[model samples]
Structures are given as structure tokens and as C-alpha cells.
Target: MKPMKTSYFPIIALSAVIVVIIMAGLLLSDAALVVDFASKKQAPSLSHPFGTDAYGRDVLLRTLSGLSKSLLLGIAASVVSGILALVMGIIAGTAPKWVDNAINFIIDAIMSIPHLVLLILISFCLGKGLFGVVMGIICTHWTSLARVIRGEVLQLKEQQYIKIAQKLGQSPWTIAKTHLLPHIFPQFIVGIVLLFPHAILHESAITFLGFGLPPESPTIGIMLAESMDYVLSKLWWLFLPGVCLVAVVIVFDRLGKQLKARFDYDNMRG
Candidate 1:
């Protein structure tokens, strides 16, 4: 058997940087302080980088705070969805044919809808704000993850080692917990990372539509919304936060693709 490639150092480094940024945003309460009323809408400079929002709040600090909230919400929602996918996938893959069919049917039904539209409808119905956005994301984002887990479990369950485990009198739970979960964990990790960009985008979209984070919040969407009034006059500072949001989304997307490629290569070699 081919040895698994544990060379995910690049992903580790990138993930670490992201974690640090998130932690800094969370741990630093000073980020909420407004240093200058006169510097409102100021351009990037040594004194007031990222300018100031309409309320004279430090735009940089507010952006970081919003980022902290976005990341926290994304992680919580993604984890719950991932766990649901893992459990449902395992059951559908390992259980009798009828069970598999039922789960598969449900997953298909969910996927048939346009994901973003469904998220919007759910968020709207659940009432506007972060809580609604979280629920909307978790509800719609699990389908693809579930399918991936189901596919992996189906393949792993039929392998010789799994059969050997069963023949050696290993309990089903033990085999799943020890053998199956371990092998599939790398894919699971990648899946979680992959979900982040989507989560960020969805959260931003909900907010942009005035149904996400509160108006006073400095979310990327809120920043953009607030900037609309000054677009004709303060062009550079007005759109700066939206540019940063695009950058963040692109960074995660590139990272996820790279990690997925590395894992796919490892899987093929194995």
C-alpha cells in the first residue's frame, strides 16, 4: 500500500495565518475604539489607515471585528453541518439498501434547488440577522458535503482491510470509529475548508440584501452599503472594504483548491 502524503505544510501555514487573524480580531477589544471624529472618511494614511466609517469608527478595526464575527459564525455553522454530513453519510453508506435510497433521495431533493436562493428564502423567513444567516448556510451547505462523505464511506466500507476487520470480530462501531473515520478525515478537513468561502460569500450577500448582520455592524456587506452614498465623491475609500472582502474570499478559495488537489493526488497514489 502507498503511504499517505502528510505534506500539508503549505495548507497548515495558510490556515495558521487565518487563525491568527481571527484570534487577533477576537482577543483585541480595543478594536472597537473610535480614535477620531475629524478623520471620518479619511483616506489610508499613517494616522488613519482604512479611513473611518460614517460614525467616525476606525474602519480597519471595524472590518477586523466584522471578520471575527463572520469567521466565528462560519466555523460554528460549518462544524454542525459537517457533523451532520458525516453521520448521515456513514449511515447511508453502511446501512441496508432502503436506508441508502431514502437518504440519497433527500439529499437530491435539497440539491435540486438553487442553493443561494434557498438560503435567502430561509434567512428571510427565519428573520433577518446573523442567526438567520447561520441557519441558512448550515441548512443548504451540507448537501455537497454529505455526498462527498457518502462516496468515501461507500468506497472504504468495501475495502479488504474493512472486511478483515469484520472477519477478525471487530465491532461495527469500532471499525467505523477507528478505521473508517481516520481514512476519511483528510477529506473531511478539506471539505470544511472548502465551505468557508461559500459561507463568507453567503453571509455577505445576506447582509447586502439588508437581511444579515445589523446595519451598525461593519460587515463587508454593511461597509459596501454604507459606502454607496459616498461612491461619487470618496471613490477609493468607499470601495476599499469591498475589495478586501473579495481578497479574503479569493484567498480561501485558492487555499481550498490547493489543499483539495494535494489530497486528491495523495488519494490516487494511495
Candidate 2:
């Protein structure tokens, strides 16, 4: 079935372009992170759009940089987790009974743990840098997506073509590579799209809790975490970064839903 054209194209394009805009903003705002003692703790004035942080850097520039870092982290975690899900799912769905049981057991074990606790432990265990945070998200986030993909492949396994291919002496690997994969591509895409908001939110949460990237990092999580220090004294610093984080997450949430709708199998067939 062909993908049906939908009204979501603009929003989807906007979502994609957002990453580019963030990247460009980060590149262009290198000088903006510089601190000035004279303008410390200014409110949201015209000269300093998002006001000034304690060190007197423009909050707007820092916010944009932080958002870009969050976006980057979200994309990294989602894509890596998605790929792990795809592989594990295919293996579980197509492999033998014991193999399926083993994979299922692991998935069950991972999902049984509290998500944030697991993320924090993993991040802390790995020393809580960029690599550690990414690894933690990647490790924890794949289980649900893997289950979805496994169910999809299991259903596809029952289809006539799959049975016919098996009977005709096609190897399992060949059938999986040529037939099963294409059939599940839509679900894979939807799963990854839906993973973004969760990834971003978790990244921020873990970071805000001081178990993610370093305090010196200019990420949304770190920004929010630092905001607690002066939140009572200077609300603008907290308000601006916090609001931008919410806005970014909301945009990604809407974008994910829109993409899922656009890629829905029924919608594509229509």
C-alpha cells in the first residue's frame, strides 16, 4: 500500500526543520553563552529577551542551546532504542520457542522496574555524562517498542505469504529480511515517532535530578536543575527555561501523534 498524502506534511516538515533550526542556533550562539557581571539577574527585558542568568548570559540564547542539546539527546536515544527494538523483536518473533521465552523474560524483567529509578541507576553507574545518559535511555526505552514490533512480526508470521515462503524452502533469515521487515516498517516508524516525547521527557527528568549530563552542560535538564537555586529569588530564569522545555516537549508530542496518524496502515491504504 502506498502512503496516503495527509495534512500533516507541514507539521512533519516543521518538526524536522526544528532540529535543523536548533543545530543552527547552537552553532550561531557560541558567543551568547558568555557571562557578563553587569547584567546579572535581569528580568525579561527587550535587550535581553529571556532575561539574564546569574552569570548575566542571555537566557534566550542559553535556552535555545539547551533545547538543541535536549533534541540531540532525544534523537540519539530514540533511534538507538528503536534499532534495538527492531532487532530484538524480529529475533523473538521468528526464533524458536526457547529463544522467544528468553527474550520475553528479559523484557518482562526490564519493564518491571520503575522507569526513572532504572534510568538514574544506569546513568549513575555509567558516570552520568552524555554517553551515560544516552546509554541509560537506550537501554531502558527499547522494551515496549520491542514488544510492539514482536507482536507485529508474530501477526505477520501468520500471513499466507510467510507460510508459503517457509514451505517453499526459504530460509528464516531470508524471509525475515525480504518479507517480514517490509511488512513491519510502518509499525517501526510509528513506534520510533512515539518514542521521542518520552525520550525527551525522561532525559530532562534524569538530568534535572542530577543523574544525567554534567552541571556545566547546557542542556534543558541541567538548566532546569540549576534553576532551583534561584527560582525563589529570580523567577524569570526558571520560568523561561521551564516554559521552553514544556513547549518543546509539546511540539514533539504533537509531531509524534501526527506522524503516527500519517503512517497508520489503514490511513496509508486509504
Candidate 3:
């Protein structure tokens, strides 16, 4: 009998759904803001599947808009954080002992603080807007990935091939570019993917606490925050945005793990 084939249908389907949500949300976000006093405080029905808010704004549209914004924010923050990590890690691994120690100290200092507290403080100090939220996430999210990359680079540097290249007059930059960077590329990719959920969750938390985006902005955090008042009133649709946010976070987390597993399998084969 033939061996069973591995199925990627789940991954492909999830990815497609994510793309559709993002695109639809981006395009319809403005429409989600439209308020209709006549339809205010609606329950889920044929006219509005997710119902309407106090301002008669469609809950589904608002949720979609918020999710898309959060997802985009996560992508931006994660990529920037990952790049920062890559640079810092490379420097820590290759530079003098003092420099390495300094980087490690900085990483330890940042990690020691509570993530939510640091994020709130940074966002508050930055004046609490889109810029503040993005900067806050970027600043706080790079330490872990930096440590990983630093360890990988340090290990590669001790390899005999790297020593041979160094003895043959190869420049440090050249060696890093050709060898270290390539070797660590997989880890870098995986780290950035993993950072997505953290960035999204942190962004939501800060915003929900009234320290990230402005209240007027249609973000998942803001939606969740506003839904608090209606919770006691039993307005279930109002909290649907929070549910969607959690779903997106879970999806991204799973995606990252899948990518890591695939990379590990490929590495083992290689």
C-alpha cells in the first residue's frame, strides 16, 4: 500500500480566509463608520448579521475593520522588531566582549519589565496614537529574537569553515553576509512570524486600556473597550469584535508554528 500523503489543505484554506478578511476589511473600513440612528442597538438578523451598535454602525463591518487594522499593525511592528533583532544580534555576536555584554544587559533589562506595563508607558509617553502603538510594540518585541540570532551567529562563528574563511583573508562583513546571514535566515523568518501574535495582542491590550489608539479609531481594542458598557445590557454583538480578535491571534500563532515545523523538517532533510 502507498504511504499517506501529507495534506496542506488546512493551511491553504486558513491563509486564504485571512487574505480575504484583510482585503475586505481594508476596502470597507470607511463604510463601517457610517452611523444610522434608526437602526441603533440592533440584534443579529438578516439585515445585519453581526447587528448594529449604539450609533447604528454595523458590528460586522466594524469588527472586520478592526481586525484588518490590527493585523496590519502586527505585520509592521513584527517586521521592524525582527530587523532590529537581526542587527543587534549580529553585533552582539561579532563585536567585542564589552559590546556583547552591553547588548545582553539591555536585553535582560527590557525582558525584566512587565511587557504590558512597558508597552503602556511607552505608548503613553509617545502621546497615544498609531505612531505610539507601533513604536511601543517595536521597542519591546525585539529582545527575544535578538538573543536567538546572537546565539546562532556565535555558534556559526566557531565552525571550522568560518575559521578557514577568516584565515584566508575574508572580511567579517563578507563572511557574515555569505554564511551567518544565510544560516540564520530560517530562524529570522520564524521569529518574525511568531512575533505577529504578540504584537497584535499587545497592541490590543494597550489600546483597550486607553493608551494606544485614539477612541475614535475603529480598532479591535477600542471596540472591545466600548463594548464594556453594553456588556451588562446583554448586547452580545458588541463583544463580537473581541472574539474575532482572539480568532485572528490564534490563527497567526498556528501559522507561525506551522512555518517553524516546516522549516525544521527542511533543515533536518538538508
Candidate 4:
């Protein structure tokens, strides 16, 4: 089987830009570059790449701050969800029938709820904050990966390698450690990249709806929500950040899809 060629230069480029934006946001917070009322709602110029918000805050800085939080939250949610899913799926897949059934049922019930609503409920229940948002997004987003991991494990357990190990008197733990886990690690990593967009979108939506991040947290959704009031007048800066948020989300989604196709095709060929 030939390994499929995959180019991640675009992802790397986008990620670099994101990192630069984060650094700028962190640095500018200590010393404001036009964040007072005088710069509020000013149009884009050589000085301000993204214009200014209602408070005259540099729109670029605010957007970058929001982007930083969004990226961090997205990654946190993806990692938490992916790890939980992998652990749960492996246990259920390798264990007895009752455990598997229970896991499957719970996953199905959770997935049946609309994602936005689930995020909001979780966020609200946990109390609004960055940590709450991360937990909320992770709680709701792992069902799909759980299912995928469960299927993969079930299939893998029946494979010749696994059976050979079992026949050789290898303990279940050893078989799983030596064979199943390594084989699934790549799929798990790829699944995580794919999970980022969903986690990001849900995080934004929850924050926009006032259930995720705090009002002053500079999250992309909060920025958009704050911008909407003055969108018609005096506050173009508030809305501009939303556009940047959309662009970043789109970039992650596109990159994830590309990587998924590349990796999945390679897996199939192998």
C-alpha cells in the first residue's frame, strides 16, 4: 500500500499567523495602542489594520485576543473530548457486553440533543467562564469520536495480529498495549484535528448566546455579540472581529478536511 501524499503547509502557515496574532494581543494588552474612546469606530488605515471598536480599542488587537482565546479553547475542548472518547471507547470496546451497551446508549442519548443547546446547557450549568466553556464543549463533542473509536477497536480486535497475540497466550492487556493502541494513535490524532472546528463553532455559539465565556473575555462570539448593538452605527469595529473569527474557523475546517482525506486514504491503501 502506497502512502498518500499530504501537504500541511497551509495549516502550518495559518497556525503561524494565529501564533503571531496571539503574541500581539498579549503584548498590546499591557500597553494600549489606541484603545480609548478617541479611536472608537475608526475605519481601517495604515495604522489600524482592523479598525477600532466602540471603546476605541484597536480592532486588530481585540480580534487577535479573541482569536487567541478561541484557538486555545478549541484545542482544550478537542483534547479533552478526544482523550475521554478514546479512553471510554477502548474500555467499552474491550470489555464485556453490558459496559459496551451502556456506553453506546449514553452516547446516543447525548448525541440526540442539538449540539448548540447542549453546549448552552452545559455552560450555564457549570457557570460561565473559559473553563466552563471548555468543559461544556468537550462534554458534547466527543460522541462522534467515541463511536468511531469503538468501531475501530471492535474491528481491530478481530484482526489477525490481535488474534495471533491472543493465541500466543498474550494477556488482554499486553495485546491491547502492543497492538491496538499504537494502531489507533494516528487515527486519534487525525480525529482531534477534525474535532477542532466543531468545538470552536460550538464554543463561539455558546459564548454568543451568553452561556460560555464572560462578557469581557474577548472571545470571538462575545466580540460579535458586543458589536451587534452598534453594528448599524458607531461600532463597525465590534463587528469586524466576527469576520476574522469566521475566517479562522473556515481555515481550520478546511485544513482538517484535507488532512482527514489524506490520512483516511492512506489508511485504506495500507
Predicted structure 2: lDDT: 0.83
| Model 4 clashing residue pairs (backbone) | 40-56
Candidate 4 lDDT over residue span 1-270, tens digit each: 565677878878977887887777676654433458866677888888887777777777777777777777788889989999898889878989999999999999999998888888878888868777888888888888888888999999989878888889998788778888887887788789888878877888888888888886667788788778876786555677777777777777788777777777777878
The numbered model that scores best in TM-score is 3
Question: What is the clash count for each candidate, in the order shown?
Answer: 0, 0, 0, 1
| Candidate 1: regions farther than 4 A off | 1-7, 27-37, 167-170, 268-270
For residue 58, model 3's alpha carbon misses the true position, in angstroms, by 0.2
TM-score of each: 0.87, 0.92, 0.94, 0.91
Give the per-residue Cα lDDT of candidate 3 at 104: 99
RMSD of each: 3.1, 2.6, 2.5, 2.4
lDDT of 3 at 11: 71
Candidate 1 lDDT by residue in tens digits, 180-243: 9988887787788878878888898888878888886667788788788877785477677677
Per-residue error at 139 for model 4, in Å?
0.7
Q: Please give the CA lDDT of all the candidate structures.
A: 0.80, 0.83, 0.91, 0.80
| Residues 63-121, model 3: lDDT tens digits | 88888888889989999999999999999999999999999999999999999999999
The positional error of residue 230 in candidate 1, measured at the CA in angstroms, is: 2.5
Residues 108-209 of candidate 2: C-alpha lDDT, one tens digit per residue: 999999999999999999998888889999999999999999998999999999999999999998999999888788778777877877888898899889
Q: 233, model 3: CA deviation in Å? A: 1.1
